[model samples]
Target: AERYKAANQRAVQLLEKCGTTQVEVDASGLLTYPIEKVDAGDQPDKKLKPLSVDEERFMRAFYEANVQEVCSAFEFPHKILATALQYFKRFYLQWLTCVYAACKIEENHVSAEEIGKGIKQDHHVILKYEMAVLQA
Candidate 1:
């Protein structure tokens, strides 16, 4: 319908105004945050863990793909998918838990215990190795 087309066009304009477009690396091989506004996570004394620049980049890139894959399998929206990816990144920012924790939170209604049980991986070992993986 014409109305639907008009509304969709308006939505695209609004998204451009709000800078909700996809983040992309530039042609020069530089990672760029294209959004108009960035809220820095700059709270001193928050006891927040630090991630190295490389680690942060890797985490974002890796989780972005992982989130997309999981969302496709689970039929989730970008919002939920993005939230899970953020949670995974934040959890890694502090202490390392099992990759299962990230997958659980991102995928919904699953737990590290359940994943470990189903996959036959030691939950304890996975948790233990988490920090080292992040460090490496």
Candidate 2:
């Protein structure tokens, strides 16, 4: 709950500072650039509304179900699926932290996919280091 509040607050701060959270997407629906700032006159007032408690709960449940669905679809081992879900949770926390920090420093924003790529790189680095240690 506190984490959610912090995340939301950070988002609010970014939106206020930049006037918008608009990220450009290419024809393939992939983010091609950093977040773009909207003119003050063009910004929408309700763009950064926080979700209600019910909405938050629904979204959490939806994500959990989706994780399970993806695991089932791929026939992933239970242990691997559990690890993936744990990583998913941590990834969002790190992502929100990064977004807030970046916005403060550079007024830049990143798409979720970009954040995921970064997290994936970190995951690979950690795994490689761990394997090296085991082999030593």
Candidate 3:
């Protein structure tokens, strides 16, 4: 319950500025969806995939660590950290790469590179495992 509240708050804060609905950047560094057109279903449609048990566990671990790193780097409140982490986990439950993409979309310009630098985590590893995480 507490985790949900935290996650909800962070998600709300992000949407307050970034707008509701999903937006993403493609591999070519082009933003695929515009916020103004979000309500119009201008974004590409993709099928929702279910996660395997192993994938769930890995995402849980990944989200927890990523949350700690992001909160520590930005000096955000514990609640915010908890919220962001929760958001990441929940998102990945439905979509794999969505967590990192959400972090970038919702938060203030969080890039994969910045995340790696802040957390001392390898960006290459994160990118490499993105597909595996999705498949898991």
Give the number of the best model, judged by lDDT. 3
Q: By descending lDDT, how would the candidates be arranged?
A: 3, 1, 2
Error of 1 at 53 (Å): 2.6
Tens digits of per-residue lDDT for model 2, 9-118 = 78667656666555443333354447665644464664556565557667766766666664465454566456545544544322223232333233233343443364
Alpha-carbon RMSD, each predicted model: 16.4, 12.9, 12.5
Each model's C-alpha lDDT?
Answer: 0.49, 0.46, 0.51
> How well does candidate 3 score on lDDT at residue 10?
70
* Model 1 per-residue lDDT tens digits across residues 1-136: 5664565567556544443433433324344666544222333343223344555567677756755665555465566666656655555431223243445445555554654565465555445444433343
* Residue pairs that clash (backbone atoms under 3 angstroms), model 2: none
Which candidate leads in TM-score? 2
Give the total clashing residue pairs for model 3.
Answer: 2
Clashes of each: 0, 0, 2
| Candidate 1 residue-wise lDDT at 24 | 39
Q: Which segments of model 1 are wrong by more than 4 Å? A: 1-52, 93-136
TM for candidate 3 is 0.35
Clashing pairs in 3: 6-83, 7-83
- Model 1 residue 115 CA deviation (Å) reads 6.1
For candidate 3, the per-residue lDDT at 31 reads: 41
Candidate 2 regions with alpha-carbon error over 4 angstroms: 21-31, 39-41, 45-54, 93-136
